[model samples]
Target: MSEPESENGAVHEAQWREVRYEYTPRLADILAHLRATIVVTTYQAGKLLVLGVHDGKLQISFLSFEQPMGVAVGSDRIAIGTRRQIHFLRAAHETAPHVEPHGMYDGCFVPRTSFYTGAIHGHDLAFGRDGLWVVNTLFSCLCTLHEAYSFVPRWRPRFVSQLIDEDRCHLNGLAMQDGRPKFVTVMAEADEAGGWRPNKATTGCVLDVDTNEVVVRGLCMPHSPRLRGDDLWVLNSGYGSIGKVDRAAGRYESVETMPGYTRGLAFAGQFAFVGISKIRETSVFGGVPIAEDRANLRCGIGVVDLVSGQTVAVFQFLSGVEEIFAVDVIPGMLCPLIAGASVDKQERDVWIVPQPGSGE
Candidate 1:
């Protein structure tokens, strides 16, 4: 049989796609209660969106980047994985005199540095014991960035034979448990080049890092595995739901079935923030349940109550944008932004690192 066609198949290479978005009035009320800012990456649209509520209205700020996918936010920094690089950014003071209409905060994420990792199909990113660990999908392995080299191979799914350009298993998501890489999601355990393409609609599984076993299976294109407390939460993308995995029972139970192709997963307090992408008629998403249902297809973020499993609020994108790869929450940051490389060189150089003599 002929090999299944890649979902991306020459669609974006020839041109650029535009993105436009709008959030509902309810989004402001929901964000006000949480008092946290959200960072979402849309690889398809090549943009990073920061969401917050300011001045009794919803603040949606965006920064342009090339195929921005994985996002991880720390107390003082934010990490974003793009097509060929990983960016490290610092928060622009939560409270400052320059705080503008965006909110009490300036909402700027000044680019501290970036790693040129090449095109490794960098997916989920997390700051682990070995520094910045990334899901290097192209090599079917997890890797960490190094100042002297491209990447340092961390671990690979047991089924993968050798590191190659082929995205054999399509390892896409990473989860950290107890400050270590715990579990990962893969489309399939195919050890051949482009082997995972045929199983895009099925054969998805979650691998437990400690035991190196497929803890859960029979998923439809899953992504974004996150460990919250003791629960392993994941976005079953093809099913358009955010759920938890029961390793002992081998059950994947749904906490909430969101609209669109659910992918990004982040949490704040008791609420779960999920990113949903408008399902395009591609080989990867065409026949999925989200596309079949048709009634609820939307591209935006869904805020759900973890305990009640109800969608509390939504920030919808009416047009221009259609896909999201990752989502992150900036805890305690009401308004935040990333200055990026576009900022003035002099302004970007404005930092205070004490010299040895200054200490005297």
Candidate 2:
């Protein structure tokens, strides 16, 4: 795409171009007609693992990405965590699925003496008949996680599945198997141990929802794993590849990745929408308050061609520059959920969640 202005004080237009690999914006008039909704937000912001409209409310969860990238999820009754301390809450309306409070951790990771995992950072989560399954990446040494280091509060999470050893990679994404207790994680790299950080696993692994076990191993930083119409799709966050694995053969390939930092992912019908966060060093700033950085740098959404591995459409965030943290496309529901913070950090917004999967 090219931006050309008129020499005289007149009107100028933008346009897009079609190339072999990328779709360049044309220099002419562009259409502007798109909208999205906010799901929810927490005071502590960083890496994310879950976001979607479940039951009758929009649910959002987060976990650190790098060190002891532990996760934090708050249900109406109380919040659960794998941080530095062990904690829990007894609530009256805790039975409610929504209303999960933030900031408070039911438990935290204590190192050395309490080292099963100081903190269990994660990406995807699934709740089935068996129980709640959380897939996460840990420092290779974490395999030695002890009972005392269980920071998941009273829940005593099954703490299932992890990446392979040797290669340090972050298992950033996860998805459930339609009706079974099966789950999948994506390895961003085709072949690597882990990210820059050590003690991480690189190989991809499969998790048994029934048993918290690192079933498979050896994969890159697979960000998001999804089961779409029987086909498994993995957003290899690091490789910028959307791949699929043939369960029978156990083979996968690098499909495609949108241009930029690809974090969370979801599906609405046949369309695959990805949460694209604007690169900080790549931003113009434009005097926009650092608080608004998320919004200001927030580019729109992009649609991926699952088969062709290409981004067909992009929903930009130039309007207000929202730094999209995570996205979940709910086809069964009317509207999808986009969980993130406004640039200014003054307030946290839960724009969507009108009526639990309601596209309101």
Candidate 3:
């Protein structure tokens, strides 16, 4: 796919068949300035988009995945939660120069391993000190991957009476602090199967993972709880607002509101990158604040100035994609490529072997 030059420095258009997008010109500049690349997952479209800057232009690489949701980025690897498995890809910087359109990309991610999780409806993921943590939504608990079983249950809220695939509560979003799981966000504190749906709009909350206590409540389908230093930030998803939790007072303070339903969130330097999606008029998304202006909602990422509480730039999808689940930033990587798990020749033919005389 090719991108047209910025139209009067306002919009940069990129199109490939039905997948069309237009982004603010400054979006490319920000990525270039930070030397970072963005990875977005759209389960609705079955795609994982790697967006970066290449030779003064914005470049996007689309990779196929089945119902890709959560994304966890480590120093040299990335973990992606999909339909029934979690895929792990390791960065192979040595192969970067040899990728097609040589030398344009600085990072090449190759499939390293995968773990079958059996469609537990995993949401957010994080690499904690102990191991890879997954918010196993269907089971209403946090779990880790294990070779002998689908998943090893780590922790579940006290209110959950049993470990079952009932989705008693939509337990999603995890925040790790100092290498350990610290806080989590849940759609509701309900204890019965599908119990959260009735009052999901006003029953959302944040929980202190360590104490298993509800620290903040009365949220509107809150997601993406992130701890930046001492501040606990989250997306009041159903309401289309980004806010911070006042743990002591059990409240959430809105920082800024956007036009779309916010879900995925990431932080880099002084800005926050949030994934926004247009909600479908389904029973699950019917009565939310953002739904009031559903027609004006967008599907893409928004760049927010954390300090000034302003949305600085936006990259919007015009067609072929909707409902983004996760957003992650690959730091220090300007342009990157991912070899997806596909049967295509490009993925099958690629091989990585140690250099001559190097230890294997």
Highest-scoring model, TM-score: 3
- lDDT by residue (tens digit), candidate 1, 331-358: 7756664554433221233342445987
Q: What is the clash count for each candidate, in the order shown?
A: 7, 73, 0
Computed on alpha carbons, the lDDT of every model, listed in order, comes to 0.79, 0.38, 0.86
TM-score rank, highest first?
Answer: 3, 1, 2
Best by lDDT: 3
**lDDT tens digits, residues 1-360, model 2?**
011222111111112211111112310111111222222111123322232333323232333222222222223211222343222222222223232343222222111112233345533444433443444444322121225544232111133223344324344455656534355453423234444233123444544335545544444444556778777766554333466666666566656645544555666544566655554543232222222434333343466655556666554433223344445532222122222221123223332223577676
> Clashing residue pairs in candidate 1, if any?
19-320, 107-336, 107-337, 108-337, 109-337, 109-338, 109-339
For each candidate in turn, the TM-score is 0.87, 0.46, 0.94
**Model 3 lDDT tens row, 1-360:** 112234222222223337777777888888999889999999987778888998878887777778899999998899999999999998798898987778887888888899999989999999988779999999999998889999999899999999999999899899999988899889898899998999888999899989999998899999999999899999999988998988878889999887888999999888899998999879998678888898888888889988899888888887777788999999998998787765343233347899998977
**Per-candidate RMSD, Å:** 6.9, 13.7, 3.6
- After TM-score superposition, the amount by which residue 269's alpha carbon in candidate 2 deviates from its true location, in angstroms, is 0.6
lDDT of 1 at 123: 92
